[model samples]
Target: MKQMTTIGWREWASLPDWGIVIRAKADTGAKSSAIDCSSIEELAGDRVRFTLRLSLKSNETLTLETPIAMRKHVRSSTGHGHDRIFVETTLELGGAEKKILVSLTCRKRMNHRMLLGREALAGSFLVDSSVDHWATPRVKKALK
Candidate 1:
């Protein structure tokens, strides 16, 4: 049997490829995960380049270029549909690394920079919403 790790409603995660640590919300209600990005430009051969703003106050940003996994039309909680660019990347969470599909969207208004959805959590995690940072120690070690 696979040992599923327990995570909280919110947790810290690292995107090693982008060299950034971000706070992510484990939302079981969402079907697909999303990442906050700005100035997304589609390149040739189904590739995209974008700048990820780590902090809203800081001027620092990480630029990344990756092939598009797919373009998905996601409906929001407000029943609004949006076409988002999807990309596959390595997500380091709870000392476990998995390649997951992430959609790039403007999330300035959201509390967390990243949202870990059902697809990313399937067969891997069991959420304990009452707790927070269940994997902080492990995640910190993985980041170092």
Candidate 2:
């Protein structure tokens, strides 16, 4: 088997498209990844604009419009289905970078600002659920 980078249940990753680092929860159970955003607006030409919330405790946010990859019907843990807008962007994590499709959602109640699911973890990472940050450097003040 190929060597895979081990990451903790929570780790810091970068979304260069928005110029900020995100704290992501590595959820192997979730098939698709999601990001916390608000004020979602769909523009002409298949693009979506929204405010990317950096943290639930802070007021930090970035309003951006990125090209839409596709929209998918997602079922929450409560068994309710909702259509989510997916945007393709560059994700930097564990010393590797790739363009990934991330769905925009309201994750204010969730512990982490971003949820890194199995689709984004496949072939790239192995989650060590017992640790908080086993790999990757903690990024600070990406905006400053």
Per-prediction backbone clash count: 0, 0
lDDT of 1 by residue, 29-78 (tens): 99999988999999999999998767656656788999999998999868
Most accurate candidate by TM-score: 2
Q: Which regions in candidate 2 have their CA more than 4 angstroms from the true location?
A: 137-144
Model 2 C-alpha lDDT per residue in residues 91-124, reported as the tens digit of each score: 8888777777899999988888899989998988
lDDT of each: 0.85, 0.85
The C-alpha stretches of model 1 lying farther than 4 A from their native spots are 137-144
